[model samples]
Target: MNRFLQQPIWRFYDQSISMKYNSPLESFATDDTLCQLVGQLQSPPTIRTWVHDAAVVLGIQDHRLPYVQQGMKVLEARGYHPIVRNSGGLAVALDTGVLNISIVLSEQAEALSIDAGYDVMVALVKALFPEAADKIEAYEIVGSYCPGSYDLSIQGKKFAGISQRRLRQGVAVQIYLCIEGSGAKRAALIRDFYEVSLQGEETKFAYPQIVPSVMASLSELVDASLTVDTVVIRLQQILHDLAHEVHMEPFHDEELTLYSFYLQRVLQRNAKMLEPK
Candidate 1:
């Protein structure tokens, strides 16, 4: 158990239930805005929920693949706009069916560590589904896309993947929960992506050979129809129970300015790296 997980803070905000935009651009903008707010200590320990239309978010390493164009094309043909993210992990699918949650806090105050950040996300998921909480486990589901040591799963089927980003003194631990739709279909897309990108070339970075059966949406795993909104509401209930008060507020103007600067920097970096060199 990490110390950060046990630390009791005076201020915490559960902004996780807010209905956000469905556009990828808007979601990216919100993430940048929240990161800036956290960096400036203008916000409380914040939890945010977001969802975007069909989009394939690629990790930095995924962009380095020899034939990434083919992978992008495949995603585009399947109604997903492939964009490389300024974060760790390989390709991940995001659609209306998926709900993304971010927990942002000050590293100095939280005494945050890498594993601590992941544990926070794991704890939040367990809180969200108490009935299945004990059944949930965190481990690298071998054949899952964006496979990681902290992958959130139940009965060997992965439902979420976690990643982190730090800006200034703030650390944002993010997770994408597959709330609905066919998780296997999403995995199949990434499986095809890896095949197209690698094209039989032996690479040192061993991308997972995806087994679609090992992944499933929360709806499937819970045996009930679920949606992002339902998960979002549950996340709020959990956070509110844990916090003094959860404020529903938008980003301030200064935070938006900082986000603009950071967003441009991230986009520029992506463009330069993605461009044919």
Candidate 2:
């Protein structure tokens, strides 16, 4: 286990319930706000879990795709809202089955190394599923969207990817866990997205050649009956045991104002990125 995951106190934020009403944009903005609040010592270390109905979160580099808009249409046609996220990574599919977790920690004492932050998330995830402790592996899964060095996998099939955002002396390490549905199906969507976006035309950046077979959900990899709700329960139990005090704290009035500011920025950036080129 990483030292950062052993905080004495932790504030839990559960947004998984109201996922239908919230967009991925709002979630990203809330993360930014939490980053500021936690970094400034206004709040304790926080763990936020969220899920969105369905969206194709594109990375900044992805916005430059030759036929990006056409590719977005392919997603929208399939009921997936397309939006370029404020973080770094290639496009990732999100739906009711996928669980997104964010660990917001302050970096005031000393800046946490990038690798250290990623390791913290890897540790927490392994703790989440003890039965698969030895099975779970972290390495890049080629042919998967948003391929990264810390891609979480089991038996060579990826089920999660970790990305980090640092702002205002805080580090937000985020991961999307494919918990319930078929992970390969989600990867297929990204495969179609990239196929449409690239149209076989070469570009400066090398977009992933997504292979759907390279991914599998936790349910498929470990237990067929696993679900987001059950995973959430496990998360709470783990947090309770790890921290001396674990509780949910509502947003402060000041924090709400700050959240609004960050929300607008995210919205504006998305609008500009998705506009016709």
Candidate 3:
């Protein structure tokens, strides 16, 4: 039973546990909760979408920046809240223009390779935009924010990047797609952030040297104006068409209760990361 080939997808896009509304922490914690629920088979395989307004989600490694405090201040002053996420990747900007999709898979289906998870997302994203699917390629977009091998690109400019989180018996493959606004401006923001954060301090891990030109929004790449809401509907339709059963499942009372615990776990982890030295 290949899960990817024959799993019913539960849509949890509109109904999520991010009660905090604008807090990226809420979004992150909710993902953790969903991962746990799906892991325990309390919930079906799920697809969730979220957008946090004016936020810069940092990787754990990003906390080591020589002047990270100052770098955070820069982001704050620029109207973006800076947060450290437990997910894979570094320094991604989120706003109304950016849309995040998480595909939750129950480990019961089988143990899937990392590439297999990423391929699932890449395939879905391409499927969502068949008009430009042929041009969308996944590779490491050098000089781009959060550069990764699964970076989804058009020509040489990247529009999205895939990341993942594994917990208990579930795997959540996540991707952030730049759907509208200026992707270069977002890259430039991170570029300036690193300049302030690094401040000439050498670190064990090499951070990306962001080149704004290497990043772009899907609208820019595809030459069409796209909005998050529009994409959300399209994604839901695609999933509905692909799966024999598509159910709208929200968090149950037990899951909500569990969310409080996971939320604290995420909060504590973030506190440790952002704790002042």
Candidate 4:
């Protein structure tokens, strides 16, 4: 299956400007908008990059924990807005120091497998940093928030996690790359979130017992001063090199309208889950 799938098969569309919303909520809303566009074939497959000021995106499982509300309170007190995401994975940290990218592709292209989607993003990362790419490996990275087989790590320290959102016939493979700042501190935030949400109570599902030291930002892991902006630029360079022609444009007004619908749906989903019994 690996050899049969062509390299660089996905069409690349880049959004020109960063989203208007400084909050993660708005960023997520934009992702849904793009997802719908790609799903409907109204837009080409895209590789969009975005940054949120400071936010903690909680997974659906994280919301089910008995004391998630209290965990959110801690996030709020620390000046980070918390919002639940419509994807897999546990809680993850996002901020100006982080770079979030989504690769929206057609599922019909070639029987898109879950691992294939993950590898596409992994391949992109490897191309971007060839020097450190060899050191980049995928594993559970135990003790890391959102532990998964595709967790992107270097020397045992995880710097990024991947998730997917599939719509009608389109697949959006997403990853949050921690480019700068203290990776351990972000992990600590999630560690504390679990502590608050679980309060040491055991549950049917085993949540990761987070060890902050296991996660480090790309800058820390590579021993180079890297910023989100720098990483974004590198991404652009790679896209240009790979694509026949790359255009940076903003979402059309019509696309924004679709996003409005998806955003409302996301809000309603969260509302229904939070409703009192």
Highest TM-score against the true fold, candidate: 2
Tens digit of lDDT per residue, candidate 1, span 195-230?
A: 998899988888789999999999999857677777
lDDT of 2 by residue, 1-277 (tens): 6788888999999998876457899999999999999998889999999999889899999999999999999999999999888888999999988999999999998689999999999999999999998999888999888999999999999999999988999899999999999898999999999999999998999999999999989999999988998998999999998899997876789899999999999999999999999
TM-score versus the correct structure, for each prediction: 0.90, 0.98, 0.95, 0.91
Return the top candidate by lDDT: 2
Q: Which regions of candidate 2 deviate over 4 angstroms?
A: none
Worst 10 residues of 4 by lDDT: 1-10
Please give, for residues 1-277, the per-residue lDDT of candidate 3 as tens digits: 2348356556555532243247788777888888888887878888888877889999988998889999999999999988899988899998888888898887875787899999889888888888898999999999999998999999999999999999988889989899989999999999999999999888888999999999999989885678887888887787777787888766778788988998898888888999886
TM-score (C-alpha) between model 4 and the true structure: 0.91
Q: Would you list the clashing residue pairs of candidate 4? A: none
The better candidate by TM-score, 2 or 3, is 2
Displacement of residue 260 (Cα, Å) in model 4 is 1.2
Candidate 3, run of 10 with poorest lDDT: 12-21
The CA-based lDDT of model 4 is what? Answer: 0.79
Look at candidate 1 and tell me the lDDT of residue 70. Answer: 83
- Against the reference, the lDDT scores of all candidates come to 0.78, 0.92, 0.85, 0.79
Model 4 regions lying over 4 Å from their true place = 1-17, 275-277
